[model samples]
Target: MGKLQLVNIEKSYKTGNSSIKVLKGISLEFRESEFVSILGPSGSGKTTLLNIIGGLDQYDAGDLVINNLSTKHFKDRDWDAYRNRSIGFVFQNYNLISHQSVLQNVEIAMTLSGVSNSERKARAKEALADVGLSDHIHKKPNQLSGGQMQRVAIARALVNNPDIILADEPTGALDSKTSTQVMNILREIAKKRLVIMVTHNEEIANEYSSRIIRFLDGEIQSDSDPIEKKDSASINQPRTTKKRDKTSMSLFTALSLSFKNLLTKKGRTILTSFAGSIGIIGVALVLALSSGLSNQLDVMQSDTLANFPIMIDTNEQFVDFSELGPPGSEKSNSKYEEFPEDTTIYAYDYSESFIMHKNVFTDDFLSYVENIENELPEEVNNISFTRGVGVNLLAEGTDGVVKFETMSQNSMMGGFSGPSMGFSHWYEMPKDHQFILELYDLIGENSRLPEAENEIAIVVDEYNRLSTLFLEKLALTEEEYDVTDFVGKTMLKLLPNDVYYTEAENGLFTPANP
Candidate 1:
């Protein structure tokens, strides 16, 4: 039986608003041992038919049978496997990757087949040697002549030992001398496998092909030899074939190709990277400046509220919701009108009396406040001047790094300007107070207060015990180690929040440069 058969294949393409039929009820057969040449004028669908047979295009109607198995139900991966395992193609333009060596170009087919590295190289070398280009294996495509490049393409097609070689005008770009060499190679390849060539050169096709088929207007015009049609029952019966592995190119191979391509166009790659970096840096700087300004504004607001007794909320109003009627009922000075039965209002028509005005404290307004502060009466106590600066405490632990921060002093102003410090577990000790003397007497110790920026004191309860949950969070459980040993041994890294967090593209903060 022939290796491939097409049964009344039909294909069409939609161009804008009209459909053009490319193939019209075409039927043909291909054997494993014949060299067939298809000849046709341009736009006659010869190349389209070849592409369909090669699994590069799909036929809209009718079945393509490969080894008596219908290919009508093949999925994308199945087609990929079929092409990788059974088909090889040589085009008129060679289609060789310009940056890759001749051997690398040949090895690409087997790369997708999941072949071993040593065997892939050996096969590639053998294929190149067969094409009499062993000495030029390391050369790039651009370095070779047109004929040499075409031979390299043939080597690439044969590297995987595909069952069929599809040549589309293999000698279209070559002189007569070079064309003869390529045809001779194809003739040799046809001895053991099916070789189908599409060409317009009548003399070359007649000389090289064992059978010639002419195509005109999407139909077969003449055939030197044609297979007789078998009964539908006999033709439709599918013979069991060995299950094949899915064809896949490895991620490493893909990245290697990309890297090589990048290396080939060094100037363009460098220019692209430089341009992208400039844009990225510009965006990063703008975001960083915006974030810094926002944080500074929060600090200014906190300072303002701390130093002054009055707080002004711009673009906000405090409303009393207690005066409103039940949820979804409109607020009214009079009793609500009775509605029809089974009707309950789900929305409210309400108007607010409070007017919105910008309460922003501009520099001019702050200067006026300063002038008032200077002329204040002696009865008023001195206003406290304070600045809110955040610090992040980091410690290395058995699990990972641990960070802690005290409750922000700005939290007293309101939740508005409050930064996310740690939970409210930290307290500031009052300096030179009578309570400190009493606490020393109760604890039976006279420890000095922290005097350095990096120094801190951990306080325990009257029972000289610490919270177990807090200890676990810091990975400093008593069962794991002597708590006393950690008193002086443990070290913490203190960084300003500005130094710790960097604004990212998504409007959140990530670790600086990380």
Candidate 2:
């Protein structure tokens, strides 16, 4: 019996409404210590056939017999054993673990086969030495050149002492010079192992194999003697490369080499991974804190507020008096007068209270907003609106009172003023101001107003508190303004009116204006 045989193999895959057949009644036989090359163009089912032979994939219909045993009847464990004992695969990408040393990678196949540690190491070292890579046992796959890495892959394949090696486009990504080196190594291995390689390069296939099988439209077009002789003078002749020591190393030797490299570069590796660890920690912390805070806020707000509470304030005055007023003046009356045409406004219909400015509603902007809305959960209910206004703060200088626009809420009031700091105040007006609107949609029943409007008239209570604490502790002043200001202002406009409009004993603010 031949070392491997595929009798009347057929494979198909369901694509859309039809089945696409890849392999069509392919029959092939490979003997021990034979080098066969399957030459085909892209989409010729060469890789799929190789995968089936390697036990990585199952053929729809076939009789795959290896070493006189029928693989068609093999179970998972049987297939695993067959693959472990009979086949070694090398891919075009040289699937080496970048983090592992050359020796470690080579030893992986034997380790997977449950070979003893000492024997695995010895066999891996011997294979590497055969590939002229004994010295690179401690080097990572990335540290070696392309040709050297492919040699490492060959060494890995040979370490398990498998009877067959299946290489798929082994030299596909290498330069012409490096490709020759890789082919020479494969040619040498085929002298003792059944090396079946799939390649598109006809010249490389002819140079290394005694038999060349051409595949077309997923069928074996021809299986015949190589048109070119192995002795043909080709550019890929084996070169006199530097050879390493033949003495094999123990498993401890390889492990020691890896440990030494890790120790020598511990700081760099640790630093590189530090940022990743920090990122994970930050994400965990944010989720934990946000969830906890949200839960507590939900409970507190739900127990106190009704579905809607009466909002009592001057017409068109949405500013929270608690933040803009003094500590004891939370319930103080504002000096501003109401518009003559003003009437009681209902907060329940506030969803349609403000219209979005046409300037801010560009197609691109709407598209972006729509994309963001799409990512939200489907249970959302209410949406809030906000507007931004530029207001000037009057500060008394040494000579005169100077008016300056408040560029940022965190701006240093001490820089432009004397000992007395100029605080911000919100004035009610009948005229609509051209300002940016920040809207918050109520998604869940437990949703609470943003703290910006909840904490009196503060732009963003939490952020302002944090910024004040930071400035106080560090004794620092603002150097640059950030978008955080806009976010804070936007959130202020999105807060529920009840949070800032009603008395504490009256429960939450109502949607009906009083």
Candidate 3:
């Protein structure tokens, strides 16, 4: 039986949506030691058949047998091992790597086969010397002539010491003299191993190949020497023993090649790095600015809250403005106007300037809030309570005791006290001295918070304006008198509710005796 056998092999290629059969049931056998040339025109499936024999391409149907072992069960790694150890390829273009030296190109195949560095170099030098390229091994492929480049390719193909050498138009790019030289070298190598070549030159094929096979329209037309069919006993020969170490490349070798490839294209490497860094830096700057602005806003909010303390008004009220139109509108409209049958007014008319909604807390709810304030000190600072108490202020004038309707009179201010009025609550001194310290900061040395029950601080508006009636009652002119003059001034009479009134019969009130 022959070393290589193809039994009714078929191959096809998909072009767009149609399948084109390249090899239509090709069957052939090759010997272990012969220079065989496959001769055909372009697209005659000559190269495809050669590729299939070398394990570079797979057949769609039928099987390829190597050393009496079937290739139908061969996986990707199995074909890889076969290509690395048993076959070598030479192309028409002398396909040597442009960036690598001739010697490095020759050693690459053995590198894939896991050969040692020292053995690879020695064998590569020997192969180059065989092809008469020993001195030019250190130069790149572009530095060589066409003949010299083809010699480098031949050296690379032979360096692995493969069982079969598959050459596709090895002389297609060389002159007659160089072609003769290359053919002589291949013929010499064929003395021990098989040499299968595909070429279009019939004259050279007849003179060089030991046997010539001609193809026509994807079919073998003629064979100078063809082997007869083998029996079933020969087909059932024992499978070749699997080798322990399969084909592989070391990590160091792979990285070395990748680094050399990158060095060959310096402009692409730099451009890629610059573009990537610009995107990363842009995202980083946006995140940093957003974080800084959020921190500043938090600090501003805390300072504002400290200056204006949070309060829960016991007499708190609201105005339902749901039906109000946009600001400065003439009238209100119902939001649910589609349901006109519902005759319930839920909000005040926008035409009305003032709307009142009282939300009075019950005694039980007030007790619950006070308990929470005492229990959760960290959550609440403190709670201060004030009643809507009305007071009558009296001062002794050059005449008799005069009565003044002060701002502390809740009944007089109740109509305007709310969010719109700003000064919503009026009360005496708080138990905490922090209120006195704050009053000192606001009014300077001339005024103080009410410490004794008989004294009171004359609080002013944001513009520091005081009521003219109260100023006249205190015997001071608002325009000319200094505020220091009003300090420690005495009033003729201070009549509180307990001193000025008494409960008469039937819950009626009456004046007390002077």
Expressed as tens digits, the lDDT of each residue in 342-452 for candidate 2 is 676533443333433223345696566445434663322222222344443333333443443333322121111111223423222111111111111322354333343
lDDT of each: 0.76, 0.65, 0.76
Higher-ranked by TM-score: 1 or 2: 1
Q: For model 1, state the Cα shift of residue 17 in Å.
A: 1.0
Clash count, one per candidate? 0, 8, 0
Clashes of 1: 0
Clashing pairs in model 2?
Answer: 308-510, 309-509, 309-510, 309-511, 310-510, 323-456, 323-457, 386-437
lDDT of 1 by residue, 423-477 (tens): 5434454333332443333332444456665665665554456666556556766
Arrange candidates by TM-score, descending: 1, 3, 2
Local accuracy of candidate 3 as per-residue lDDT tens digits, 300-336: 5533443455555545455545445348754444345
